[model samples]
Target: MKLTVVGGGSTYTPELIDGFARLRDTLPIEELVLVDPAAERLELVGGLARRIFARQGHPGRIVTTSDLDAGVEGADAVLLQLRVGGQAARQQDETWPLECGCVGQETTGAGGLAKALRTVPVVLDIAERVRRTNPNAWIIDFTNPVGIVTRALLQAGHKTVGLCNVAIGFQRKFAGLLGVSPADVHLDHVGLNHLTWETGVRLGGPEGENVLPKLLAEHGEAVADDLRLPRTIVDRLGVVPSYYLRYYYAHDEVVRELRTKPSRAAEVAEMERQLLTMYSDPALDEKPELLAQRGGAYYSEAAVDLAASLLGGGGSPYQVVNTYNKGTLPFLPDDAVIEVQAAIGSNGPSPLPVPAVDPLYAGLMANVTAYEDLALEAALRGGRDRVFRALLSHPLVGQYEYADALTDQLIAHNREHLAWA
Candidate 1:
């Protein structure tokens, strides 16, 4: 099978390459293409990718290209991990929102909306090209604002599934804590991308015994620490919220802390500088330990599993993925993309039925779903009013005044990326 990675220049690509190398038997790639516009970074990452593959004794041929069409042509799957604007734009996305007193996150709040607007158009153009080249190829999107991006891809009638590492990361962590293999742990992970909750932890398989209560009872402090939430909160909720929820549960506190610290984008930019320097070394053939601190933990495993299943290869029968709700969560619209456990195979992911959601989480999910609708509309058709409406719809920026200011800030910081602006 052939696979193409858009944005293969990203520092995160090594993680994916490592996964592809280790899981070669599962996916059996024949050709791998790395597509990116940054020729220098692409060379560094692509070289390391080849070395890693060779080091692992994988026979797949690796190629790098700046031409998106050529790179994706006739591929079995095209994985989208592109950042429309590099870390420089992300720095603005993560900083300007703070000027409006909102949490300036790359994948949530006003910043996330800015990223969505910038990313959707570019991704659609690439998807259109991919479709023209190979209509049968599956598009596995690992892009940020995944819920919005995946929605755009689906609405455009492309064969796509959004992937995230959050579920897999949680499974691995929980397994480590429980003294079990990661594969033996199953999470009742639910909600939208980034904004999700682990409603249950089943051991052995999807239908395995629920050990969540036991986990909480025995390791509440460690779990809470991982999430950066108070143990009391976890004990009270009887569920674990993804770390992203902190921006909501403690919005003001997080905003305050963000104001004090450098934007995560800035930190990542520096990290990338260091990582690229390391990638330049001809002798470094394996993924560096520093990449662990770069985030997207277990992303390689998640992407490989999703790609394998999508290609009709045997992989985990069930995994968490971002796809159409199809009434899995009765509160969400059928078209709304949600991250949940699903049976994966040749036909793609079919979300399993989820138990009734508590009003606490359901209400937030519904609110965010509405905001995402407006965000997507704003992304598709650009205008200040659309931007304002989307911001106002967000629970994080509910006030009209804040929305007005944020809309202007978003546009000002991203004018170069926003054609309408």
Candidate 2:
């Protein structure tokens, strides 16, 4: 099979390469193409990718290029991980929102809306190119603001599925805590991308017995610590919220904390510099340990699993992915993209039936889904009023005063990326 990575220059590429090398038998790739505009970073990442493949004795041929059409032509699948604007833009996304007393984050709140606007158009253009070159190819998006981006792709009629590492990361962590293999853990992971909760943790497989209560009883403190939430909150909810929920559950506190620290994008920029330096070394054959700190934990495993299943290779039948709700959650619109456990195959993901949602989670999910509708509109058809309306719809910046201020700040910080600005 052939595969193309649209942003192969990313520092995260090595982790993906490492997974492909180790899981070669699961998804036997013959040709792998790395497509990116940043030639220098692409070269560094591509060299490391080749070394990792060779070190693992995988026979796949690796290719790198700046031409998107040439890179995607006749590919079996195209993976989108591109950042429309690099870390500098992300720094602005993470900092400017804090000025409005909202949590500064890349994939939530006003910052997330900015990323959606900047990313959706570029991704659609790339998807259109992919569709023209290879209509049968599947598009797997790993980009931020995945729900909004994936919605745009689907609305444009592209064959696509959105992938995120959050579910896999939680599975691995839960398995480690339960003294079981990662594959033996299954999560009732529900909600939208980034904004999700682990409602159930089943051991052995998707049909396995629930062990979430046991886990909470024994390791609630560790779980709470990982989420940066208080243990009492976990016990009260009886469900583990993704770390992103902190921006909602403790907005003011997080805003205060964000103001005291450097932007995550800035820290990542430095880390990328160091990682690129490592990738440049000819002797480095394996993914560096520092890449773990760079984030996207277990992304390689998730990508390989999803790709394998999508290509009809024998892999996990059920996994968490972002796809149309199709009434999985009665509260959400059928077209709304949600992250949940789904059966995967050559036909793509079919979301399994979600159990009735508690009003607590349902209310928030519904609120965000509405905000997402407006955010997507702003992304597709640009205007200051559209942007302002999207910001006002967000639960994080619901007040007219904060929404007005945030809308102005978001536009000012991202004028270059916004066509209508």
Candidate 3:
């Protein structure tokens, strides 16, 4: 099968290439295309990709191109991983919102909204081109603010499914703690993309025994430590909130800490510089260990599994993905995109039914869902009022004055990316 990666030049691409090489049997690829606008980075990454494939003895032909249309033409699937404004823009995304005395993150809060506004249009345009080029191809989106991006694609009538490493990351963590294989662990992972929780850690399958309580009882401290949350909070919730929750649960504290430390974007930018230097080495045939610290842990595995199932190859029958709710969480609109476990196949992911959500989590989910709705509206139909309303709706930026100031800051920092501005 022919597969195309839209941002194959990203430093993260080597991690993906390593997975493709190791898991060749799961999803046999005949031709792999790397598409990116930046020719220099693409050439460097593409060379390493070819070297990795050769070192692995994989026979797939690797191609690199700057032409999006030609790169995705007649492909079985196209993976979108582009960062519209690159890390320089991300530095802004992770910086401006903090000035409003709020958490400045690339995927949630005011910064996330800024990213959504910038990303959705570029993704939609690419999706449209992919649609026009090959209607049968599945568009696998791995962009940030996945819920919003996926929702935009769905609304545009594109065949797409969003992918994230959060669920898989949780599964692997729980499995390692439980002394079991990662495949044997299943998570009752629910909520929107980054705004999710592991309510139940089931072993075997969806209907398997829920071992979440046992896990907490035995390894609460370790789990809490990994999430950077207090053990008391984990014990009280009886669930593991995603690390992203810290931005909400400890907003002021996180803001204080963020103000003290260098932005994550700056750190990643430096790492990319180092990684690119590593990638250019002719003798380096594998993904470097430093890539692990670069984040997106297990992303390659998640992508391979999702792609295998979507492409009609035999992969795990069930997995966590971001797709239309379709009433899976009765509280959410059927059109809302949610991250949940689902049965995967060529027909696309049908989100598995989730048990009744706790009002604690459900209320937050509903609130964020509304904010996402408004965020998407702002993304599609640009206006300062829409941006203001969306920020006001967000739990993180509920105060009208804060929302008002944040809107201007978001617009100012992102004027180059926002055509409306």
Please list the C-alpha lDDT of all candidates, in the order they appear: 0.94, 0.94, 0.94
- Give the residue spans of candidate 3 off by over 4 A: none
* lDDT by residue for model 2 (301-382), tens: 9999999999999679899999999989998999999999999999999998788999999999999999999999999999
State the RMSD for candidate 2.
Answer: 0.7
lDDT of 1 by residue, 236-308 (tens): 9999999999999999999999999888988999999999999999999999999999999999999999999
Scored by lDDT, model 2 comes in at 0.94
| RMSD score of candidate 1 (Å) | 0.7
- Against the hidden true structure, what lDDT does model 1 obtain? 0.94
TM-score against truth, every candidate: 0.99, 0.99, 0.99
Quote model 1's TM-score: 0.99
| TM-score, candidate number 3 | 0.99
